[model samples]
Target: MAAATPGLIGAARAQSARKTFVFVSGAFCGGWIWRPVSDRLEQGGHKVYAPSLTGLADRSHLLTKDINLDTHIADVVNLIKWESLENVCLVAWSYAGFVGSGALESVGDRVSSVVWLDAFVPTDGQRVADLAFEGFRKAIQMAADKGEAGVHGLAKIPPIVVAERDRAFAESKVTPHPVGTYLQPIKVSGALQKVAKKTYIRLPEFPQPHFDKALADCKGDKSWTTFELPDIGHMAMLDAPDRVSELILQAA
Candidate 1:
């Protein structure tokens, strides 16, 4: 009988500990928003993907009135399928909660855990309009009336606190988010809740009744784990990447 060498044992341990993380960005933002946290996770020997949804950021050229919630869901579902990812840790931010939830309908079996980070958590047949504030609803309507594919300027007033140095860079990267994605009702089948690990993280420095309510609701659910990072704002990934990465790892 032979014992495993330290290097071989470490390699085996790393392989066992490795995880796949798919970060879904919020409205008016793109995969770039997940860079800080993704980098940290990748450094820890995990496979991390932060894809820009259709009609946003790098994909802004594809923006059109035709892109809807299903389009975004396919974007994620296909990513999982084509990437051949299994036992994934799905992380959704802001408006992506709905998108992620919808995606779970198709890829839930592939997902081991789901985390909603300062994001919406909708039930079946609920659209973003159903959960969004009046101001947000108005913004979507205004964009529709203007015959625009997306709603602009919403990112100008982020609920999250951006440091001065990162402010300009972050502002420059934001693109108009497709309005169709918001108007369409997400079709979920409790797929998200079915995942083995469910978590809700609230970044509460700013006042957002919707996220506050989400945190409270999840707290009442025995199946879901909840956390509050009150020191940071809504974009906790950027404001506190270390903490965000740590939480995702814990959930995984």
Candidate 2:
């Protein structure tokens, strides 16, 4: 039998050192959005958890007027605690940033790193509506007036950015996001800042004021390692999974 190669041994050692990752998806989306990136990390022998929030995507059936930011936060915290995961790299995208911030309050000690992917970083008592644009807040109000528990009709990503073949399926999977999640204020105890390693990946192609502010703030902060992917769209994981995976791994 041939002896094991040095390259193979080194690869094994690197894989063993990889940390677990918990990916929180953005609004109107779910765990499915992280598939492109998660698949790559899993292939590299890393544990990755990307659960759909309470009232989005596959879990849309659970939608209710009462599902708020706290509900989504519990979904993430319970997953980490129940699984007994440690050295986790908590990754949040877009609207899920609020969820990640709240979850960190309970499970911050278990997380070794955090990555905010074009996501809002809200301070204490800040709600998504506060950070969101006036247009978005109006949309949420309209959704409520229409007797809907969730909000829809927002697509920040241009059709051209997604692969032509995957466009239809991708559109079908985006369900109405719980309206309460946007309206409810998130209670943050600065747990997100306490993570040993923090990163922020900004996609400049899809411009939004909140995201612009987030990028600027992270760039100014000494603790955060920031990266700007000017070519990628809002959905970096799907638009450029390889690049997103590389960034996530670097954070870990």
Best by TM-score: 1
Per residue, candidate 2 scores C-alpha lDDT tens digits across 9-50 of 998899778779999999888999999999999998889999
Candidate 2 ranges with C-alpha deviation above 4 Å: 1-12, 155-166
| Collision count for each candidate, in order | 0, 0
- For model 2, state the Cα shift of residue 20 in Å: 0.5
In model 1, residue pairs whose N, Cα or C atoms come closer than 3 Å (at least 3 residues apart or on different chains), thus clashing, are none
Q: What's every prediction's RMSD, in angstroms?
A: 1.4, 2.9
Q: lDDT values of the candidates?
A: 0.88, 0.88
